[model samples]
Target: MPMTKFLKNDKGLTLIETMLSITILGIVMLGVMTLFKQAYLYTVLNEDKTIGINVARNALMYMEKQNFIEIKEKFASLGNNGQLQLLVCEHNGSARYTLIDSNTSPLSGCSDIQINDRKYNVTIETEPPKNNNSDYANYFIPLVVKVTWKHGNIEQSTQLKGVLTSEDIR
Candidate 1:
């Protein structure tokens, strides 16, 4: 009778082990993809907020550059309604400020303008010089430009105040 020997050998991981590893890898990949998607959305929302802020700042700068006396004169013609008519203009690296009236109410042929958006109020206030002193004595008015908007269900505002004089104009 011939003697029979049994040989046991180890080669590589079993099919079940390989499949388990692949499943774990897939789960991890899904988690990473979800994280990336969220991050991308957040970045996009932030960029929109930034753009809104810039638009408000530009509007304020344009108001600042105007001749205080001229603005005052225009307001005089506007009467009490002038404040409500305050208009915004886009210029070269700045914005334009105008006053509208009931005649222009409903903002015919106008877009990209709103009194409030994102649950925040945007405002521009002018603080004229208390006294007139012609010689570098702050003859121009101080302007308060504010842009308020909402972020993540929270309201916030960005303000830029400046004391400008005729000399500051270029």
Candidate 2:
């Protein structure tokens, strides 16, 4: 255990070498953690988009199945820029439908829709038929279904367009 014998022991790492190794490992781990955070963020964003698209499609389908006569009566009262009434199904897997008038603010009653802790707002707008298509102008009901939600600080939305041929129209 003399000084000369201890200094000759090259098999073990020096104190400086061990500290440098730990510092490098820490830097590499920090970069890896950053990548994981970004991946999770993108995954959640994509999930919200997919759910928004599903909500829009379901709303469009529901409106299409209803009697055009009754729907016309509802829209007729509002005239131009009439928003269709959206009834969201039960939030807890029940088929119950609740009517929410689009004339009010989207953040009103529709705010009850919450999935995975995210609140979704759905709105349907009736657009006038295109000028180029005169035949459709009389017989077609142009509709746009938009589903909006807040993802963190940004508000994200998706829309689906559909045309319903009216049998009641002359």
Candidate 3:
């Protein structure tokens, strides 16, 4: 009889029970917030990567459209006394043009690009083509384009490669 009366009077949680419930809810909310933070960070990193790759690819494609002669002419105007020479080399039985960056050393003609209000540095490197059976070097030139940017004190970069053949000269 006494137990029944006590149970009837208990209509709500005790103070300790209420505090424990509130604590558990807070912990769960903290965990969820942490997960969301990580996900957002990951998304940001992936977006940067994608942008870098695209920039490099665009640079490479631009080079691909130019033939060896055109590139030589362009570089000749840039300086180094027409030192930009393409050499033919044989590698693994295939012929390829090797790009020689003469007196310019690091070479010039790099362009800057902007994406998402962020600035990126893009550089292009050239090499002579390589092939098997022939020593003709002016047939093609290999190019590498690299894109770099600073992401929160960390440097990030991406590179893409392509070849410009003489046939492309039109």
Best by TM-score: 2
Q: How many backbone collisions does model 3 have? A: 18
Ordering by TM-score: 2, 3, 1
Candidate 2 on 83-116: residue-level lDDT in tens? 7556545455555445455675543233445678
Q: Model-by-model lDDT, in order?
A: 0.59, 0.75, 0.66
**Residue 110, model 1: Cα distance from true site in angstroms:** 4.6
Q: List candidate 3 stretches off by more than 4 Å.
A: 1-10, 72-111, 127-140, 166-170
**Top-lDDT structure, candidate number:** 2
User: Which one wins by TM-score: 1 or 3?
Assistant: 3
| Candidate 3 accuracy as TM-score | 0.60
**Cα lDDT of model 1 by residue, 1-170, tens digit:** 23342123246777887999999999999999999999999998776567667756766666666677676565456554334234544556554455444244534333334543533344555555556765534345565656666667777667667664554454
Model 3 worst lDDT run, 10 consecutive residues:
102-111
The Cα RMSD in angstroms, rounded to one decimal, for candidate 1 relative to the true structure is 8.3
Q: Which stretches of candidate 1 lie over 4 Å from their true place?
A: 1-10, 72-97, 100-122, 127-140, 148-158, 168-170
| TM-score pick, better of 2 and 3 | 2
